[model samples]
Target: MFKMLNQMLNRTLQRVSLFLLSVILMACAGTQSPNQVTVTGGTIEGSLTPQLAVFKGIPFAAPPVGDLRWRPPQPVTPWQGVKQTTDYGNDCMQLPFPSDAAPLGKTPAEDCLYANVWAPKDADGTTPVLVWIYGGGFVNGGSSPEVYDGSKFAQQGVVFVSFNYRLGRFGFFAHPALTDEAQENGDMLGNYAYMDQIAALKWVHNNISSFGGDPDNVTIMGESAGGGSVLAMMQAEQARGLFDRAIIMSGGGRSLFGDRKVSEATQESLSGEQYGLNYAEKHGITGTDAEALAALRALDAETVVDGLNLAAMFNPAQTNKPTWAGGPMQDGELITQTISDALQQGNLADVDVMVGATSMDIGGNPFKDKDALFASFGEYAEQARKVYDPSGQAPFQVVGYAVGQDRTMQEPARYIAEQMTSHGQQAYYYRFGTVAQSSDNPGAPHASDIPFFFDTVAEKYGDALTQQDQAAASAIHQYIVSFAKTGKPVSDNAAQWQVFAPEQSNMLNMTRNGDMQHGTDPWKARLDVVKAAVESSN
Candidate 1:
C-alpha cells in the first residue's frame, strides 16, 4: 500500500511539472517577438506563435481611475511608441474572488480599462472579428484569463479581442453621491461597466479593420456576465451596429436588470460608513463626517479588500444574498429597463446569435432534497421544486440549481430565440451537456463549454484529460473557429447545428457521447412565470 501511494505521488508530481512546463512554454512563446504592423495608422506590436500574431495589452480606452472611476469609458489616448503588446492589463476594480470565481493571477487595481487583440500572423486585412467579455458575476474577472487567449482564434484567421470593465461596487454601485443633477448627459446612472463594454465595442468597430479584421462583421462573445452583456448590447439601440453576430457561453444573465442593485448600494454605503467609523477609531482620525468617505478611499487596497469581499458576500448577486439583492441595476442609462423586455419588443441588435448555458453554472448548490432547495429560495421555493423534482436519489439542491440555471440562462437564451423567430430573424441555441470525464458530475457543468469552445482542453484543463479528451477538444475548437470565421459554427467533424425558428426550434445539445437533437423549447413554462412577474407589477 505504501509503494502504491508512492507511485501515485510520483505520477502527480510528473503531471504537475508537465503542466508548469506547458504554461512556461506558452508564456515564452507569447513573448518570443514578431514583426510590427500598422492598423489605422497606429502601430500595434505583436508576437509570433505557432500560427498566430498575438497582441497583448492594447489600450482601447483610457484607464478609468481617479477622476474616471465611476465615469463611462473614455477614448484611448494614442501613444507614439509601439506600446509593447505582451502583458495583460489590470482587471477593472472589483471585489476579491474566492467563492464565486476561480483563481487567476492577481491584478487587483483601479486603472483597468484596457484591451488586447489577436489576428492572423499572415492574413489579409479583412477577417471577421470576435470580441470576448469575461465573466465573474459582474464583480470579478477580466479579459486576461488564460482560457480566453486569442492566439488560437487568430491562427484560424479571425481577429479576437478582449477587454476589461469594472466589476462589483466599482462597476455597478450608484449612490446619490455620484448621481447628482450635474452628471445627466446620458451617463447619469450606474452600470458604468456596461458603458465600458459599449465603448470597447465602439473602439473595435472603428479600429478592427486595421488589424486585418472586418469591422462590418464583428461578433461579440463571452461567458457569463460577458454573455449577459451581449444580450444587453443587443437590446440597446445605441449599440445596434457595433457587432453583427454574437456567441454566448454559460450566459449566467437570465435578466438584464438585477433587482437588488440599488438596495445593495444603500447597504454598501451604510456598511462603508460603519467601517470608516471603526477605522477612524483605530487611527487618530477626526469625526465621522464626509471625511470618512475620503478616508475609506484612501485606505490601502489590501486593507479594504477583505472588507469588500465580506460586503460582496452580503450582495444578492453573489449567490448567498437574498434573491432580490444586488445585481445589474435597471438604470435607464446603462441598461434599457430590462433585456427581457427589450427582446420581447423589437428593440435589439439585428444580428445572428448563438447562445447557450452549461448544465450547472459556477454555483455548486447541493440539491440534497426539496426542503433544502425551498429553504434556500423563499416564496419561489415551491415553483422551483415543481419544475425540478429533486426527490430522486440525487439531491434536490442539484435539481433546484438546474431549474435556477434555466431561469438564469437556458430560458433567456431560448427566449431570445423565441423573440428572434417572432421577428423573422434566424437564431441558434445550444445546451452543452458534456460532463468532464474527470468527475462523475452532471450534464455540461458551468464553464465546461469554454475549453471546448476555445479548443484549449490541453492548454487550460489538461490534468484530468487523456487521449479521448484531446480529440474532443480538437473537434469543439474547430466548431467555434469555423463559426467565428463564418456565420455558421458547423464543421464536417462536429455536430450539425440548426438555426432556431418558431416552426422548428431545432438546436444542438452537445454531450460527451455526441451532439443530439434539442429543438424543443426548454423554457416555455419558466417564461410564463417571468411574464407574470413583469405583468403583475407588484
Candidate 2:
C-alpha cells in the first residue's frame, strides 16, 4: 500500500510542475512589448527589426474622400482594438511618374493621409524627432519609397517620421462652389495640400512623445516641392511653433512667378477659382451650388486625378490649358504672402535653417531660344553668357539648363540662407557636387542628394554603389543627424560646417572627388548677376 501511494504522489507533483510552467509562459506573452504604443486613435502594435521598432500606416486624419473631398483633413476615426501598422498605407492619388528616382512601394489611392515612424527599440523619451516631407513638384511623391527608409536614422538614436499629403489635382483644386462651401463653414480655402501638411505636423507634436521622441526638438526637412512647403510653413501663421529647425533641399527661395502673372485671369495662367471652374466645365459639371459640389465629389478618384503627374503637368500637348491650380497660391489664412516677400519683410518663424541644392538644378525663365533667355537679363546679357556659357560653344540646351539652375535653384538657396542669417538665425548652406560613380552625368543632378541625406545610397545604387558613394552618403547623413540632435550640424567624418554670412559667403561643398570642402560659394559671382537680374525685374 505504501509503494502505491508513493507512485500516485509523484505523478501529482509532475502535473503541478507542468501547469506552473505553462502559466509563466502565458503571462510573459501577455506582457506588452515596447513596440506596442498607445496613440490618440488607440493601441498600435509595430514590427521589430534587430535595431529598430518600425510603425507604418498610422492614420493621421480621415480620408479626404466623398463629402470630405477638397476640404481640410478631419480627425482620424478612433478604433477599438490594437491596429497593426506594419505595412505602408497608399500614397496620395496620382499617376506614377515612369522615371521617378524614388518609386512608391504601395499603390496610389485617395485615402492616403497616413503617417509612419521609426524609433530605436529601446527609445526612452529623450530622442529627437525628424519629420520628412517628400517632393515630386507637389504632384507625385509619397512616404512609402524604400530609399526613404529611416532605419539608419533610428539606429543613430533619433525617431524619424514621414507622412503622405494630397498630390496633383486631388491636392490643390479650387472652384466657385468649393469657395462658397468653405465660406459658409468658415473653412480655409485653397492650398488643401498645405493644410494636410500642417495637420500632420500637429499630429506629430501631439503624439510623438508616446514613441519616445522629444516633441520640442522636432525638425522638418524636405526636397524640391517638399522644400517649398517647408518655406511656406516657416511663414504660415497657422504653422508657427510647429517646428524648431528646417532643411530645404533645392526649394527655391525666390518668387516662382518672377515678372509673370501669378493669380489673375489671364491666357498664361488662370486664378485658382477660374481654373477650378474650367476643370468643372470640362467634366460636364457646372454651377456654384451645393449640387455642383456634390457632383464634383461624386466623381471617381481616378477621374479627379485626370492622369496628372510631374511629367504630364510639363507636357505641352497635355497642359495647353490650365487644368489644375498649378500648386499652392496665396490662401490668406495659411499663406498670407509670397515666400520671398515674407523673407524680405522678416515675417517668418524664428528657426535655424539648412538650405542647399545640387550642382545642376532646375530653374530659368521660359524662352523659345538661348538668345531670348539671355535677353531677359537685359543689360546683364553679356555677363550672363560670360559666366554661364563662357566657352560660347556649348549647346543651347546645356546653356539654358545651367541658366535655369542659377535663377531657380542655386541662387535661391543662397538667397534663403542670406535671409535667415539676416534674421539673426544660424544658417548653413551646402552645394552637393559629388557625381554618383554609377552615373555619367556631368554634375549631381536635381534630387540626387536625397539618398545620401537619408543614408540609403545602397538602396539607390544597388550593386553598383561604390566606396566613394558610401563615404559621401555617410558624411552628409552625419551632418543631418547632428543637425537634428542639436541646432548646429557637426560631422566628425567631414570638415566643420561654418555659419553662413553675407560677407563670408561660407558654404560646404561636396566635391566630385568625394571631399567635403568648406569655403566661399564657387558661383557667387554668377549668382550675384542672377540676383541683380531678378531684383531689377521685381
Candidate 3:
C-alpha cells in the first residue's frame, strides 16, 4: 500500500536565510515539546505564532545561484539542532507588482527555495497535514498577511504548511545551453519551482510524522498558480502517493490538454537576452554569456530588484507564443504529460476530492456595464446564443460570462467530480454564491468563498452576517473537514450521495442560509455549453 514512499531520498545542498519580518517567536511552556530552543535552520531564527511551536526552515535544496541556476532542485541537508523559522522568508525574485503603489511588506530574491510549516498545538500524533502553495501566476507570490496561518486549521486539529519557490524568469527558464548537462532523470532543465514543491512534499513525508502529523495522511491544496501546481503534482509519477486528497480553487490548469510541445516562439526570451544585455550596458556592466550571467548573478540584491514584469515572466523564455503563455512546459519526468493526458490515461492517484469555483468569477466586474457586456455576450457568442439567443437581447452575455466562468472553473470541477464518482471514488462539489455584505458592499467575489471554505469567514474580518452566513459557513466547513478525515463530504446524512454522471446533470449547491440542494443543476447546461465552446476555438 505504501508503494511510493521511497521517492523521498533526494539530493542535498545548503544556503543561509534572508528573512524580512521581525519574526515574533513564541512558545508556551506547558506544551509537550516545550523548552528546546534555537533550532538551527537555513532561513530565519525565531518561532511563529498560532501553533506556537518553533519551526526550522530546512533547505529542500541549495540556492540555485550559479551553475545550479535554472536547473532542477537538489535535496536539503539534514542538519543538527533546531533551525529557527520565525520570520517570513524572501519571496521568489521577480518584477515589481502593480500593488507597488501601496506595498504591504518585503519583495523577493533569487535564493528563494523555502518552505514554512505549522506544528501542532497539541501532542496528538494524528493531526492531518495540509500543505499550501500560493498563487501569483507562477511568478510573484509568498505566504503573507497570514492568509495561510495554520492556527484556525490547527484549531480544528490539522497541521498547515505554506512556502516560497522560484518565480518569473529566474524559475522556469529553459535553454539549449542548459539541456546538455542532463541528469539521468530524462527531464529537461528549469521548472525549479516545481522541483521545490516536490522536494518540500518529500520533506513532509519524511519529517511531518515527527511533528504530530500522520505521514500517511496528507492533503495537497492551493489556489491559482498554486492550484495549477496541485494539478501538476496530481499528474506526476514521482508525486504519486504523496497526497491523499486535493482541493483546487479558482484554477483550471490553463487548458494544456493535448498541446505540449516546445514552440519556436521563444522569441520573448531571445528578446529578453537582448534586453538583459542592453540593460547591463545602460548600467555600465560588462559581460559575455557567462559574463552576462555573472553580471546578473553579481548585481547586489537591491540592484537586481527587477523592475516591472511584462509577458510570462515565469518561463519567459518559452512563453512567447500564445499557446504556451501562462502555461507550464510538459517536460517528461517531472510532468510526464498534460493534465488532459493524465485524465485520458487515468493516471491521477485514486484520492478523494473537494473542488469548486465562485459565481462572481473574474469577468463579473466587466459584466456590470452594457458595452462590455455586448462585447463579450453579444449576438456572436455561443453561451449568449445558447441562453439569451431565444430572447435576441444582449442580457444573455451575463450568461456567457457566467458560462465562461463555468468553463474556466465549474466544468472542470464537474469533470473531476464526475470522473471520481465514476471510479467509485468519493467526491464533493460546492458553489460559492453567497453575497456577504461587508462594511460597505457585497462580499466574496471570485475567491470570496475561500474564507468560508476554509471556515475563516469571520476570521477574515467578516462580521456577523445574517444567520444565513453562519449556517452556510458551518455546513461548508463541516463538509470540508469531513472530506479531509474520511475522503467523503456529506451533509449530516446516512444517504450515500447520488453519484454524478455526464447524463445526470446533478450537483450540490450550498446557499447563503446553509441549505443544501441537489438535483438537475443549471450549471449542467452551462457546463455542456462551456465544454462545447472550449472545445471549439474562439
Give the clash count for each candidate: 11, 1, 7
Ranking by TM-score: 2, 1, 3
Whichever of 1 and 3 has more lDDT, that candidate is 1
Residue 8 lDDT in candidate 3: 33
Which candidate ranks first by TM-score, i.e. highest?
Answer: 2
- Positional deviation of residue 226's Cα in model 1 after best superposition, in angstroms: 1.3
* Pick by TM-score: 1 or 2, better one: 2
Q: Between prediction 1 and prediction 3, which has the larger TM-score?
A: 1
CA lDDT, every model vs. true structure = 0.65, 0.88, 0.58
- Which rank order by lDDT, best down to worst? 2, 1, 3
Candidate 3: pairs in clash: 11-75, 12-75, 39-82, 39-83, 40-82, 40-83, 41-83
Model 3 clash count equals 7
Q: If scored against the real structure, what TM-score would every candidate get?
A: 0.77, 0.92, 0.75
Candidate 3 whole-model C-alpha lDDT, 0 to 1:
0.58
CA shift of 363, model 3, Å: 5.1
For each of the candidates, the C-alpha root-mean-square deviation to the true structure, in angstroms, is 12.5, 3.7, 12.0
Summing lDDT over every window of 10 consecutive residues in candidate 1, give the lowest-scoring window: 316-325
Residue-level lDDT of model 2, residues 360-449, one tens digit each, is: 788655788878988989889989888888888888887787788988899889999999899899999999888889898888988899
